[model samples]
Target chain A: MTSSAQANVSSPVRAEKPQRKQMSDMTIRNLFIAPTLLLLIAMNVFPLFYSLYLSFTNYSAIARKAPVWVGIENYVNILTDPQMWQYFNTTGKYTLLTVSLQVVLGFALAMLVKEKFAGSGIVTTLILIPMMLSPVVVGLFWKYMYNPSWGYLNWLMGFTNPSVAPDWLASSWARKSVPGLALFAVVFVDVWMWTPFVMLLVLSGLKAIPDYLYEAAAIDRASSWFQFWRITVPQVAPLLMIAILFRTIEALKSFDLVMGMTGGGPGDQTEVIAVNLYRKAFLGQWQTGEASALAYIVLIIIIAISNLYVRYLNRLREG
Target chain B: MATIELRNIEKRFGETYAVKPFSLTIQHGEFVALLGPSGCGKTTTLRMISGLETVSGGTIHLDGANITWQKPGYRNMAFVFQFYALYPHISVRENIAFPLKAEGMAKSDVYKRVDEVVSILRIENLLNMRPGKLSGGDKQRVALARALVRKPAAFLMDEPLGALDAEYRESMRAEIKRLHLSTNATTVYVTHDQVEAMAMADRIVVMSAAEVQQVGTPADVYHAPANLFVARFIGSPGMNLLAGPRRGEKVELPGTGNIYTIPAPQREVLQAATPEGKNVIVGFRPEAAMLNEQGALTGEVYATDMLGAYKLLHVSFDSDTVVHIRCDRMVSHPIGARVRFDLDPQQVRFFDATTEKAIGPTQSAGTAPISVQAANAQEKAA
Candidate 1:
């Protein structure tokens, strides 16, 4: 009976007109998706090519260097320059330090805020204020706090000895350490501010889990540690990965704090790639060609990091 | 297997009592249903037993040990949720293996048990797929399989089939019954649908307004509902009710001008329970109301609902109230046509005007075999 019914209905289903109609319908469906596709391409793709083209040309906003095709000259110079390498190393250290602290502190804050309690809303609101404040304002405020003489940092550190009170913006110690300290300060501020963001996202993710799943886990007589590892972590991973990716992107592009606090420092010791690019463009005698090349280099590094983050995001989504 | 005992379990959220002094003992290997409408404390009772919700005042005992303060895991029972609660990221095999793995079972044994459950649920082909990719019925089977694989003390399910399509729910209902029979596991199922409760539960615990109305076998509850709420709740087309006065020998409906001669014994019981010339509500099952050529109380057929196997003819009186008469499916009754119907006086039930509880001894009527003596005693007490 099944075979006879299948035999009767098979031909009509396989008819050509239905197939043609489906194709046209799909084309019309694709038309609805076109705007989003074009927007994404314009925002992400066009800038990439524009920067790539600028890298080979000596295009400067001030010097207005007519782009002579100096194939890889800027690349060769920037690759070999010790100062450029110094900036790369500085940027890498900042990214690693900031992202790690953000993740750990973010996880802790998320866990704390996830539970229902009195005044949790106020705590969350207070914690989130630092992140929402402008980066430039935060850097300026910290600079005032670390102003060496009347600085709050010195006062807080309790420097009774006038001789031992270290210079924050002048000496070699100040140069190397100030930028790193400022970056750490920014990272601390980032963790303070954005940890709540991570908490909010993770809180929603945690709440989404029906209480029955945890009950099931408990009925298995799972230990506290075991439940955290198996159920809690697995449930929170997808959102955590997304949060980490967002923080990483923001950390790699860190520039405002270093600029406002150290001003690329006692001797270019604190200059990240973004700050270096700024210096080359305007401060270092308006070397537009070198700045364009440096800009392209920063763009390349960001693209590589973003690509890695996107791959992890895609894998998390799939799982 | 474990015997779960609840001693006057009460729960309150803020100021409102969600469950009021609920008490019951679930025997080992028995299938019981907490059946009621939404917000009637059925799910709340199930959660309290599972230790997911804290009881305001109660003691919970499982297998002779008081576990009132114990956490959910210490209760040693598996719960299949209405949402399935299958981790969407995990494969079907892992979802089934989760409880065993959490208990630190060996890898080989976990795999073997997963395989056993997969075969039992006929989901071998779907073992490698994630829950997000499965159909609704398939996901339901996976949830059932996951719950059963643990073979814990008992299973508490909250409307597990509520999300399935009608055909799938029917098939799953049969499958769940078979699963229960094969395993002989104690199960507590919650549902608003009386049909589901009647079809699946060995005993149905009827609840309403944060209180347990009655607990009995499906046949017992259907034939002898304790109050007006249970009577209307447990039956399809519900029980037809008419408000009237019980005179010495006959009860007369004032608005419809219908008088029913009361049996002498029932009249005596009614007299003892209530004052003479007092108003009372009379109730009867739709199937008990039969149409006869030579009967009293003429009414016009308002509507006919054909349900394949049985048909219901809704009859309306000159008064605003209506009563449904169950009849054969193919036996067509035209709407707007006048029909005379007789009430099987023996099958009728009387409830107190103030309390709405069954008031007197009800004789066996229609296909009902059990005398509602217990219900009458309860009504008298009420």
Candidate 2:
């Protein structure tokens, strides 16, 4: 504490080392991480496990009553309901359309700007703008653009032949087994907003491929088409899988875009599972028990998709 | 077998020439090495031959057909990169099959070719394993197999052993030479290591500052470098050079009154190449000097280095110059021990002090000095 005490040690500069050694690594790790750890448990972990508990019980937030175990009744009811099946089918169609289009367009765009040119930085920044925008805003903006009368989209379509331009977001869900125009419209907007993210990932993967590989391929007498399929595509596959995994899970939880544009309108044509879950939890039915069960079901589906994707990623890396 | 000829082949990047115009014809089945330090355009020259890099001027003839502007894939020359650029996602079998598959070869035929090639390389165990799982030596074997599978017109290897460990490089060098002996493929190898070039190449092309210093057989280049740069660059410790003005038939050592007598043949060659009493540099390899008490040149050992196979005495003549002399491995030459030595009359070389070109005897004399264009000004500055 004093200069005389410090003088007792020959190397006064390194005296702090002894005090540092007093703190065990475990205690130091906990000391630094305790705040973030507590906050994460309260915000993320508590809700996750508590929701798993509630998935098997009957409880209403508004009723202010303790939850009572319902013995998987909510799960049975939700799974048995044909409306829930329709909503899941709608989400699956949306995910399939959005993720596929995004992967193709993303990979193509990544290839285009792979070699830097003048203003490529500006072009990349412009492309990434949609991903940074609020999803609800994008959804609302596209809904306005899909307006039948005096909309930018319909006006542009009118040039090609106005007669062929059908209603964009007004198709009925009840009369069609195939996804309606409204679902396609929502899928289109999601592709527009998220393709850039996929492009960024693919671009990094492309950058990691050394130039000598291409030179060697050319020397081996491989055509450009052969090189693309044999070299470029395989090298970028792992990162592409990661992009697909992210987009699929995001599409499964599609809510904001549907809420902002169709709002499950045109006779519930675009009622994805997430939108239905929101309605059941908060808006109309106030069925918290069914909502929790649905949430768990979605979580399980995500885990399953993630498991398959992780396996694919591992296989890709192993090569 | 393929014959490749480059007529005045040179490469330029914008205004700077990466390789000054020079020409050489590689005979069928010859293993020619483009040897130089880094950025000396050896790799670029190899790339030009492979058609991966375009020549700024001059034409390339492959088997007497003009292929200067041919696309790399159409040329059918296999290029082995320094880093074995094996297709990472594919197994070794698929990688070796790739070039064949591109030509629309049948699946069974591809497998047969792969089997034959892998058997030669003794890498049958590696066929199913992906390239990532192979060791450095195994990866090199797979790369060689991939190149060999195509039976390409020629092989252009760009420092193929540069990335391997020292032990791997030695074995791989011998393996490549053995493969060349069997296949008899016209191979152009690029390397910075002189030992690798001397060990494997049928002819070594030494280049410096984007110009060809000399192109000759390994022994020829070893004994007869074309200029000062070649003399200084071609050996392990490089050839020792001592500059002195001619005094009759002897070279007058500047500070000391010691005079080195010129041998009869070299004396004739030097007198023919130069005016009387002109300053010239005498070049001799480390082994060319042997201890002689009655020898004209005298020096004390400044340092001693043990090279396992032999010993090197760093003999200091004056304040500025010290030359290495090789001796028997068991011999002891402590530091500061006074020793006199005589240069081997047969192995001694002469270079004009100003021009730096070799004042060489008729038999070992190379062509006139190539005008080294100052493509990069900084090189001259340094």
Candidate 3:
């Protein structure tokens, strides 16, 4: 029996199959998925490559001529422009203010609602309503609410003192006296719309913690304050960082809210990078090449920051 | 070490009572186990002693001081959870040092204490490894080290070995017993596994459906169960019980047409404890009954089991009544074979069929007969 088994293993036999026209599994699978792959490449990959090609050349939408190879001239011009630096500074400040506020307020709200109480489900759903709304719709509604004359905020402030109703969107003081107020108007709108997104992520993180850990800590004679610092904070830190990373990227590329609320106005006081790119590409000179270059620069910065956060997240998971 | 006394402690969630009013006292350095099936209030009782749950009706005294309303942190006890609950982010050294550091101990002192505990649990090699990197048994050792570092007022373990493999559980059980002897910390363990309770605890408190059934030494509970619940719950495969009505000097087993002659002593106790024309249950461990050529009780062998160290023959007197008889390993009985067995009257116990409470000489000395009203109240509460 052993010799026969060894002989069978040593010998290789080949058998011929009957001819058929049936498709193989791999071919059938690829055939089914072909349409989605084709549509994705056409809609997304094509535009991305076209924009990269346009970034290094002189291209104008209104020119009606073939774009000329400029040999890095668009990148050089955008890199050296003082106005571009100012736009970057504006973008940095807006990202810092909005994302930081969203993280702090979002985590605080998540902690508050982590435990079940009467009507908590309804309250949590209501809190998430703002994040569920379309950004365009939110911007449009907030614009009317920021109107200096008949806005609800000004009217509500009219109750205390009818004399001083600070101009929200087009305040001259925002440009001359306090430049931050102009930035604050748009930052407030963004924070209101996105804080709920951060809250939902952190809430899931909070929910993943088991109750026995806290009970064990209590038995170990750890105070409430000690439990918060030692247990609660460490358990939620990774998710909180992820929330911050997402909000930072979204804030850096902010355009719709700024456009609808302040239009980068009171004289470019709130002209973030995305809004400036929009203005350069479509509004006035239509410098599509320079705008594309600026867009690539923003993308690189976002990728670098996101990579740092991802590394930290991996380390946290390992720990 | 400290003595923990609970006086009529009860716990309620909304309108449903999780624990009925029960009182117990744990002497200093005594190891007590709360043994019961799932949802039988064993864990709840352990949590109350640890001050992790609030008592709805009574007070608790730790070392003669009232600590009923004190916070769990202030109660100065350590809890080992079923899943270990070791902080996943911390190293074994840091996890063991947590309770000490929380008390504002000096860093040098904390390290020294952690080293001592790690050596005791033989987890010194795993000091720098986080819980996430450790195996389940290693994590359990670290959890035990953490609980042992502080020398708290008492230790409360909620099925700490329940998650381990069978072999690991055996070693951990011995480890816990050794630690209890060396540390002499008052310990309250909660588990549904009767073997764990019998092996490690000095006294086992058996509970059923939010009520205490019996509390006694391991041998006492096994040899003499207080009620039907305790009798059936404390043994492997449980005690074999035959229910029937008493007639003259024998029990006429219902539906089996079989008669078990009651021994002279047991017959007297059953007659005094229960009225005539009422049902009675004869209880005996599987090991207490043996095969004999001259035995009067006869049945057909329904099944046979070879349990390595011994053989068990499951004999059926009728379609409904079956009893197990333990025999020597070499004694093999085939299925459908006729067998005769005799129960050792010295190990036999009788129970009142109506109240389900033990009716024998072995019922704890000086205990009052359960009144009809109290039995009715217990039924309604259940």
Candidate 4:
């Protein structure tokens, strides 16, 4: 009687749900993925193709005329301009300076913090604040610090000598040459903000390297310096290359930092490609078509540079 | 050649021990294996000898010199890791030459050393490949080549074949033993595999619970375990133990009506070790139980397993006890069938029930086990 009573309770639970046709795995997968796929096509892919089309046409944001198909004229104009070349040269300088300094300082910092000691976790977390910061905020604060009169930098510079605290924003030497002292000021800010990114990458790479490799190397009688050259450096190279790739592109497209800090002032010494593109498209006459062409040129360049680095990265992995 | 000595060396984390104080002397050109289960401090002992781990107390002597504080690099010993930690960014040739290059040898001499090692390992075809591109076996061979190229004072291996599949493990085990015979470099190997330790080691150091349980040759550990742990640890199917209260001439087995008669030779030793009313444990290898019509013990067949060369019959003398016995593979026994078997006097051993240590006169062939003992037992088996 007890067994029949228990069976009476459990049987209806099984019978309550009627059999339903099952969905195939592929159909269910597509059903779940369609929303995300459509959103991506609308938000990202459409804009990308639209921009590619606009790159070949003469279209201005404030103009009264419809966009006219100019075919390669805007591309030709942007490519032939010497000032655009100068902007690219400045972008190249910025990429090179920021990437190199960030790699060196970041990798050194990673090594220093790799060995755990008291408060090391706190140090790592604290260093991530700059990388977490918005570029515009960093630019504004650094701009305040770089002010010539009664600014924090000049106040500190007055310690060495009062009379020789030169103007940072208005120095003639900065405006006289490409990538002069004023450009270095902005480069310094970029490096300050992004060095932690490289540090985190190298830290992860260092962590992935097994302790046994170093043990094996030590047992092989390889000196600490030898181990660094043979094991640590080579082991972390691919990650370092990835860090370089990220920073190079970011530095090339730097707009807000240079705009907030220098505003391409002192006669455009610190104008990177992105800042120049911003000025061309929106600030002055709104040359949107030429700016669009220039943007595509920069995009192609980024792709080429990334392709090279990725190839090198793959080789490092396989080698 | 190098002789490594650890005298009362130990490791501790706060109040707990990773390895309690223990001492052993590995002679020059001898292959010694520190054998135990995971977390048994065998790896820690091997690391201490290699100077990769600093001893919490006591000094380590290398060839009669106190090299306890020496840097691991300056120790001039080669270590092969279990996972084959080859330098991933270099060719196998550069990997083998890494140490020689560090020594500031000329390029030609470095290449010559690398070539010599590759030829010795018969891995010349893999010279140009990176370690990531090699198979597990090939990678291990490259790691071995790297270690051998330096011709260091000694070699330390931490379960070097533990990562290989069964197909490669046997061949690599034989290859490593062959390498040892050819080099005759004093080697310290750490492994938890009894088969590995038994096959290659000149001396096996069986460890448990952060202490050395026993140290003996493979045959000694198998035939005459120094304690119950070694008896349970050394064999594929470990020794069968029957606990009983010791009576005048026979021990009354628990959970069974039968009584065990102490084999004639060890009766005096067994009686002397335990009090008259105290309990003793009888131990025997599976092969030591012989089927006889007028056998001393009778039990029902509890289970049966077909080993490759023999059938293992588990006999239940009562509901609570089952004893494994090896019989001819051609014979079969149904479950619950009565089988009579007698223990071979030569292979029987007795342990004190309280201390879990073997009684004296532990071996029949005089090949006594030295695999047991440590300076401390408060933190015995972990």
Candidate 5:
């Protein structure tokens, strides 16, 4: 009966295909998929390879001249320039501060909301509202909130004492005060906006865990502290690492918030690498080749970090 | 080992009770099984004892000490979950050693205890492998080893072998029974499979709808189920129940138009438990009924099942009612053939139609067949 059924199914299919000049299954599949593949190559791969070629040239947007191949000079110049290194340093510090704070705060929030009680769903959703808002909008409102004169933050600070409200956007060198405080202010804004993204990821990981594990741990006489370490942390670590990886890449390429809030103000203290690349490519010099080189460098670093995380994730899944 | 006592323990989720007020005492080193269908509060009672669930009322005692409100960690018991619940990130050795390490046992002692358990479970080669690499039966062994490594006051297993294949389930059933005997730890095992409960537990507590139906030794409960629920639940293919009217010493089978003479001892019990002009349900195990030439009941054979050692013949009486009769494997009756069967008077039990409680000769008095049958003949002649 099964063989007759198979033959019946195949006879109709064979007849249908042959009536229209038969194509191989792979060829038919490719015919359907080719349009999306072409679109992706045009949108993603074309720019990637085009930039790679431009990175070895001296192409300038404003010069209106044919690009000349510089033979790695753009790469050499960007790698050796101290000003470029300073921007990279600023980006490194900002990424470190924002990603670390986001991971810790997000994991803490996920832990708080993990068990689920009355109104916790609403509370979690409310906490995630900042992440859903436009980054430019967040930066614009936070810029206003940081105004030293009449901002709500200063007003709240002034309730205690007016003199304690330091100038939030003041450059440390100009004030002869703490350095990178303006950069910290920008990092703080990014942290507040993105911590919820990390929390959302970690919360899903927490929910994936079976309740029986905790019950087993409880009956095994493990302390709550020990259970947290042995059961909760190990189970959530792979997802937490994923959250960290995403936050790291986003923090490294941070631009919109810095552009809206500081625009590399306060003596370039808050100018991250992406903002620096933007300025070099679009502003005064329009050094497209050099900017592309810097972009490639940042991409390589991000890929290397992500690869490490993926390897660890595979090991975690295996274990 | 410890005496675990539950005093009127109950569990309520909002307004509905998950487990009604029930109490049972498990003596030290006893293997007791809470047997029931799903949603029957057996697992709930096990969790309440493990302190994983809070009781709505009543106190739980461990060795005569009240530990009702104590933390599960302090309750000093180990639980083996149905899904094994092994720490997936750790190796089998570490999983087994977790309870010991959690109690702050010295590292050397932890390794020693883990090694001993691994040997006992015969999982020595699986020690270094993570739980993800182990099969279902191996994972269950690892879970059991983890529960046993600490030598806690009691061990609570919640259908630990429920996930295994049938072959593994049978082997693991014997393994658990052997382990329970060697360890002699007080155990409260929960399972819906009566075969596992009968083969392993010293006492089986049958429950349904969050209430305890009966609690007794395996043989006691099997031979003398207290209520209709247990009579239906505790056996494979279950007990066959026939609803009929009872008049004096005889009960009329409604479907087959037959009357069975109630033996003398069972008649006395029926008279005491039921009033006149009422219906009674006759209950008997399939093995207790036999195909005979001069049998008292007759039915048409509807289906036959070859079970290797015996044949189970499903005989239809009336339009809808079917009664199973266990006959020798060689006894083949074609479909639509009329068959006659006889129920051993001593093996028959009767339940009141309304209350559903057993109304027949008690198990002890029913076991002496010669005297009971002789007396039953005299009563029938009278």
Candidate 6:
């Protein structure tokens, strides 16, 4: 009976003891983690929300009048505008082309460096140097390289023709030609720069594969091609998916290279969504509301792509 | 099923010789274990046989055909890796079906074989799960299931149970033994654990330093070890070897002043071979040197451990030869107490100092308390 009375006192104490302990632990974690999270929310989350709000209102930079709640008007106007749609199409084309080419070239370069070749480290370092450099610098460099008179590519191609050198940045041919060439220039630069990132990921994944698996595969009499497709591909798939997702997002939000290289060029023919949005918001007299809506649209697209990648990462972890 | 023969096989990795001029003939349906310490060419030999490693010299024959240059799959042998290299992305069902599918087996047949192996291994519950989700034991079973599904000419297993916990290893050992019996496939297994080799193998090839020391049943390797390395390597506590001088019929032990008499059958060889008072290494099992009232040597107990069925006693004599004696677990003795022991001359062997080879006549080196000689005799007869 005395023990029972002690138990009655101890049970509540024991139950409350864990609760208090958990509360203190949580309080300690909150003390450390809360401020950084709050700072992030204020800087990023607040701007995002304000941008969304501005997107719904007709906020003007020049008029100095209070923004009127215009609801779907900005969205409708942007949707009806053919130039906006053209920019959208150009953005899609640019993203798809660059990402595709980058992945293929990156994967190929990764394979080359993956082997234990002499000077591979130097080569890898050289390849990665492009990505670390200023994007604006890259744009300026390519702009000079594509110059009509003495550009390296033109000079190289000039050997095939004595006098028929086409101007890379002039005429209707140049308008259509230069954007693709410029897009490819950016893509080549991206591949040259970012292939090392893909290579590093793939190399780690490749290393995680025990040599014994390849030995077993060899014992199974699998051809080299079979081993690559069956063993190498499957093993590298998860990392490759992650790499593609990353590059796709980066490609879609491509702004700086386009800005530095062409500045929307030759009657807005080379204008991507980013360039078009910049022009609408800053160049054209005060359409901050529409710019904000366009900015939110970019955010939504990025988040959707990022969410898919997150799910993929979760699946890989589970697997 | 086919007999596999390795003829003077040598495998060199750059300057280091992994396996040196090794030869073996494994009869069909016989389970052989290439037993040794790590880096002792046992795995290299297995790999060479399975065609995983290219031979630097000599040839391999499967069913009387030279297969040294052939690919592993063409040789029709399946290998189970030590790490159980199951495709991590594939489910257990797919892992088991891989080898079969590799040979382009029909879908229906693959399903049937996969189903059969899964049930046999009792991994049906785990068939849909990836190797990442499987436990150590389950992964090993799946590896085995995969190897066996194809029913190739021979099976090469490299320490398949090395990764499992002790308890699981014992059970898997039994499972492997049962599978070997039922399947009757010509199998070559590699392991460092003598107990595993003893339990699962029909014949064990004892090796060291890229060369085979002996090839026989577990009993033969234990009782009739071919050399100094094998005598020390094959047993648990190892054979007790005392270096001394032989004069007439008696081999005199150094420091301890213990005299061992050469049996009548081996007396002539001892006299002709060993000069009077010439040093030699006399070998005997710990059980051969036992506790007796009318014993020749006196020892003090150094340590004792009660190992379930038997107790192990480490006794240090005046000569500093600490002999390990196994007694019943119920028996107890104080650590400092002096104990008397007799060296049974009938159950002893002699080796030459120069060659480190067994030379003098070997008698019933088994009749000692922990004798495996009867098992040895039975195995030799088999």
**Winning candidate number (TM-score):** 2
lDDT for each residue of candidate 6 in A1-319, tens digit (9 for 90 to 100): 9999999999899887886656677698888999999999999989888888999999987877998999989988888999888888878887787767766776777777778888988987787787788878887887777666676767776533424554554422322444455555555555655666666677667767778888888777677787788788788878887887887787777777778777867556568888888887898656999999888888788899889888987787677
Could you give candidate 2's per-residue lDDT for residues B1-382 as a string of tens digits? 5888888888998989899888788888989999999988899999898888899998999999999999887776888888999999899999999889988899999999999999999999988998889889889999999999988778889899999998898899989999999999999999999999999998888988788777887876788887888888888899999999887788876437558888997778788777778888888999999888887788889999998999989998888989989988898877888888888888888889998878864125454432222122333355
Cα lDDT tens digits for candidate 4, A28-133 = 8898999999999999899788778888889997998888899999989988989888888989988999999999999999998998999999999998899999
Least accurate 10 contiguous residues by lDDT in model 4 chain A: A170-179
Candidate that beats the other on TM-score, 1 or 3, i.e. the better one: 3
Across B26-135, the per-residue lDDT of candidate 3 in tens digits comes to 88999999999999999998888778888988889999999998988788788899999998888889889998888789999999989888889999899999998987
**Deviation (Å) of B196 in candidate 5:** 1.2
TM-scores of the models, in the given order? 0.85, 0.92, 0.91, 0.90, 0.90, 0.87
Residue runs of model 3 more than 4 Å from their true location after superposition: A1-32, A159-163, A171-176, B253-261, B363-382
**Model 2 chain A lDDT-worst window of ten:** A170-179
- Show where candidate 4 strays beyond 4 Å: A1-60, A66-71, A159-163, A172-179, B254-257, B362-382
Instruction: Name the runs in model 6 displaced over 4 angstroms.
Output: A1-46, A159-163, A166-189, B330-332, B344-346, B360-382
Better of 1 and 4 by DockQ: 4
Better of 4 and 6 by lDDT: 4
- The DockQ ranking, best first, is 2, 4, 5, 3, 6, 1
Residue pairs clashing in model 3 are none
- Report i-RMS for every model: 1.9, 1.0, 1.0, 1.2, 1.0, 1.4
Q: Count the backbone clashes (under 3 Å) in each candidate.
A: 2, 0, 0, 8, 0, 0
Candidate 5 wrong stretches, greater than 4 Å: A1-43, A159-164, A172-176, B255-257, B360-382
Residue pairs with backbone atoms closer than 3 Å in model 2 (clashes) = none
Q: What lDDT does each candidate get?
A: 0.78, 0.86, 0.85, 0.86, 0.86, 0.79
In candidate 1 the C-alpha lDDT for residue B197 amounts to 100
